[model samples]
Every structure is written in C-alpha cells, then in structure tokens.
Target: MDASSQDVARALLGWYDVHARDLPWRARPGCAAPDPYRVWLSEVMLQQTTVAAVKSYFAEFVRRWPSVEALAAADEGEVMAAWAGLGYYARARNLLACAKEVAGRGGTFPADELELRALPGLGAYTAAAVAAIAFGQRAVVVDANVERVVSRLFAVAAPLPGARVAIRRHTDTITPSERAGDFAQAMMDLGATICTPRAPRCLLCPLSASCLARLHAEPEQFPVKAPKKARPQRAGKAFWIERDGAVWLVRRPGKGMLGGMRALPDDGWSARANGNGTPPLMGPWQPGGVVAHGFTHFGLDLHLAVYEGDDWSSLTASEGEWWPLDSIDDAGLPTLFAKAARLALAEAGEVG
Candidate 1:
C-alpha cells in the first residue's frame, strides 16, 4: 500500500484499539474472532436497522437458538414470531433459509467471501462482513458508516449508488492485509462516533488531518445523495372479528406482504395496490378507526372494520384461529397488524 494509505490504516487501527464500541457481537480488538454464528447473525439483524434497536433482538435470538443447527431446527412460524416488530420481514425468512443451508453443510460457515455469498440470502456486503469479522479475512467491508467515512476522507462528490464503486476502491487501498477485521470495525466506529453525518467531531477524529471534506469545512456533504422520490400512499382495510372475548386472526399467505405472520384478516392489500378483497364474512361492520404505518416504499392507512354481527357459521369454514384478547400481544403480529389490533380493541372498549 502507498505511504498515505498505510498511515491512514495505522492511525485508525490505533484509535480503534482504544475506543471501539463494546457491542454484543464484537470481540476485543486484537483478540481471536468471535463466533461466526454471532457475527453473521448480528450483521443480518443490523441491516437497515440501528444498533440500539438490534441489541435486544439479537440477545433474544441467540438465547432461543444459539447455533445455526438450532436455528435450522426452529419452526418458520416461531422464528417469524420472534422476529416480529423488527420490520423487513423478508430478512427473517431469509435468516431461516440461510440457517438451514448452513446446518445442512454440518453447521460450519464458510470462511471465503464468495462461498458465504452463495448461502441463501447472503449478499455481497454480508458475506464480506462475515469473512472479515468472523474469519479475520481481508475483505473490503463498506457498510453505511464506512461509506460515509470513505466519502468524506476522500471528499468524493459523486452522489451515492454511483459513488459506491469509487468508495469501495478507496476503501480497498487503506484496508491493511493484517488485522483487516479490526480495521473494518475501526472504520465503522470512526464514522458512527467521530465522523458523524451531521456536526462531525472532526477535532477528535484520528484521521481528521487526512479528511478532505473536513479540510473543506463540509464533512457532512461528502457522501452526496440524490434527491429522494416521494413514497407512495396506500390505503387498505383490516377486519377485526371478536367472539367470546377472543379475536379472530389468520395466518397471512406464505408469500406476500407480512407473509407467514398471524394477523387480523385484511382485504388483500399489497405493496403495489390497496386492499380490495371482501371481508372474511358478511359484516354489519363498524368503523373502528385507521392505523397508519410506513413500509420501505409506501405509507399505508389501514382502515379497521369491526364485525358487529354474531355470525358464527360462516367463520367456521374460514381458515383462522380465535386468540384470547388478553394474549393478543403474544401472537407475533407485524407492527402494522399489531397497530390495527390495538385500535380495534380500543374502539371495542376491550382496551383503553
């Protein structure tokens, strides 16, 4: 590596050795790598999620299913339930699939980046992260934090999605062949703590002397982003049918929005379209209220319709179960459905 690149990696690793965040999945700098299972699981859970939000979930998951084999043997429904409220339901499904794949291969994760990528649902970024953090391989690990750090350090003015290629190249130059795992984690810690997106603490940054954007007095402006498109607005309906102090819930179709989770029956709303299917049974339905939720691509206003009739025969032929009102919280409903259920309960005087 070039002199400047060598200096950059050295300074950052030095800082990381002293100031790395004490995260649940991390090993002490310069120590043996943590369990590959923990590394892989944390990386997956942290995707599109924050550290504060993932800690509890990661702890609970490892507590319940400590290894790839344990997770592989887990029921899909239970796993999905455990993953409730984490959002990105697809990740939970993919997690199960990847676990099964690893279990079939004798429960040992592959050390090579490409082999890890071949596993179900494992992407380039995740594979690289696992390779570096779990196996101490020298892979270019550029997560969002690393992206910001690299963009600012080099002052790359190109907007993201296009700037990523250049960012990765720059990251490669500075990634030391040894201690690459520590180096990668150092970059992440530096970005997250010192070179923040806004009001960066440049004065305290280890590489502030080499930061082009800091020199320009605009550290936050380096990882330039294209303007965001407006998220689409979607409307849908959820039916809440209560009988004998219990509410009727259905397992959503195994492959769609909020798939494989138990939820209040809806009128078949989708990401691409509003709900239009008929309610589960003929209802002299009362307007309970509306519950608003945001997805990655759209915002939804799910209207709630409570069944007012005592129709028992029609629901018998339908596919659903009666869950006790007091135990509704244990049903593992997605956030959207959970919100809908709470609104329905409040409207029915079942909950305040």
Candidate 2:
C-alpha cells in the first residue's frame, strides 16, 4: 500500500474506533466470536436496505433463530414472513436455500471467498464481505459505501460499470494485512456517516485532510453516476374476498413478479388480466382504491377489485388461504400486497 493510502486507512480506522455506530453482529470481547451465520444473514438482509430498518429485522431474526441449525430447520414460509417488510423478496428466497445448503454442509459456512462465492446468490462483493468480515481474510469489499468513499477520495469521475473496476483496484490496495473486518466495516461507516451521498460531513471526517473531494470543497461531487430515468408505471388488478375475519391470500408463482410471496387473488397477468381486468374471483365486484407500488424495474399501478357476498361458501379461488385480518400481519405479505389488502378490505367493508 502507498504511504498516502495507508495514512488514510489508519485515520479512518481511528475515527471508526470512536464514531462507529452500534450494530448487531460486530465482534465483542471474549463472547464466542460473532457467528459467521449471523454475519452472513445480516449482510444478505442489509443489502439495498438501510441500517435503521435492518436493526429491528436483525433483532427479530436472531431472537427467533439463534443459530444456523435453527434457521436451517425453519420453514421457508416462516422465514419469508420474518423477512416480509424488508423488500428484495428474492434475497429472502435465497436466504432459505443458502441456510439449508450451509446446514447440509456440516453447518460450516465456507471461509474462502471462492467457496463462499460458489454458494447460492453470493455475488463477488458479498463473497468478499463474508470472507473478510467472517474469517478475517484480506479481501476487497465494495458496497455502495465503499464506492462513494473511493469516488470522492480520489475524485474518480468515470461512469459506473466502467468505474467500478478502477475503484475495486484501489480498494484492493489499502485493505490491509490484518483486521480486515474492522477495515471493511470502518469504510462502510465512513461512507454512511462522513462521506454521505449528500452534504457529507467533510470537516469532521478523519481522512478529510487527504480527501480529493474535500480539497476541491465538493466531496459530494466525487464518484459521478449516471442519472436514473423516470420509472414507468405498469397496471395490474388484485382481488379482495373475505369470510368472517379472514382475508384470502394466494401464493404468487415461483417465477416472475413478486415471485413466491403471498399476495391477493389476481388474474393470469397483471395488466388486462386475460381481458377486461376481472381477476380470478367469482360473483359481482366493486372497485376498491388503486394501490401504487414500485419495483426495481418499473412502478406498479394495482387496482383493488372486491367481491362481498354472504354466501361465502359458494365462492372459492383455485389455491389460497383465508387468513384472519388480525393475524394477517404474520402471513409474509410484501409491502405492496399488504397495502393492497388494506385498501381492498376497507372498500369491502364500506360496500358490505
């Protein structure tokens, strides 16, 4: 490592020693080194999610399943439910498969980055993270934080995709010969707090003296990324049918939009729904309010369709469950479906 980068890393670690946020899974003194399983689970859940939101979910998961053995033994549906509100449904799905795989492999998570990357859904960055944080291996961990930090430190202006490689090369140099986990975590914390996307606290930053962006008095301008285009809204229809206090929810197909998650009855396709927008339900229907949801690729415009009949026994969907409204919170409905369910039930009650 160059003397300048070494000084930067040392300064940043010094700052982290005092300013690092209290997060779960951090190794503590003499308390059975943090479980790699917990570390792996938290990292998967925390991807594309903020630390504040991850805290509660992490606590809930650790409390529910204390170890890899317990998580491996858990039902897929239950794991999905526990991870419901935290978006990225696919991660939840992969989490189950990976847990099971790790358990079957003698309950030992691979310490080598190559072996970790070979696991299901473990990408290069994530593999590097697990290798460094879990086993103290020297590896480059480039998450959004590291990207922003590197972008500003050297003022790399190249667009992403092309820029990521250069940034990765830079990160590889300063990762250090030891304390790999703390260095990676320190970089993440520095990015989140000091080198934030907007209005970075440049003055308080430990590496500010050596930061290129700080030298130019525009640390926020480093690591230039292309602007995002406007998200197009796509339309869909959802059904709302209830009996007693139970609302009907069906398992979305294992492939495609919101795959494998619990959702309301819907027609074959989201838009037009086989034609005329009537979902997979029977009897006369009422129009519930439209519920708006956003996915990674496009926005969803889902119209709630409700059918209320006293002869509830006469109406049945192909495959679904009637979950009590009171207990529906535990059914692992994604945010989008949960919002739709609320609207549908409200409209159903008004018409009934």
Q: Which prediction has the highest lDDT against the true structure?
A: 1
**Candidate 2 local accuracy as lDDT?**
0.82
| Best model per TM-score | 1
Clashing pairs in 2: none
Q: What is candidate 1's lDDT per residue for 11-101, written digit by digit as tens?
A: 9998988898999998765576599999999999989899999999999999999999999999999999999999888889999999999
> What overall lDDT goes with each candidate model?
0.90, 0.82
Candidate 2 lowest-lDDT run of ten: 267-276
Candidate 1 lDDT trough over 10 residues, lowest sum = 343-352
TM per candidate comes to: 0.96, 0.93
Q: What is candidate 2's lDDT per residue for 217-314, written digit by digit as tens?
A: 57777778888777666777788877778887888877676778888877544432322576565577877798877777777787887775555664
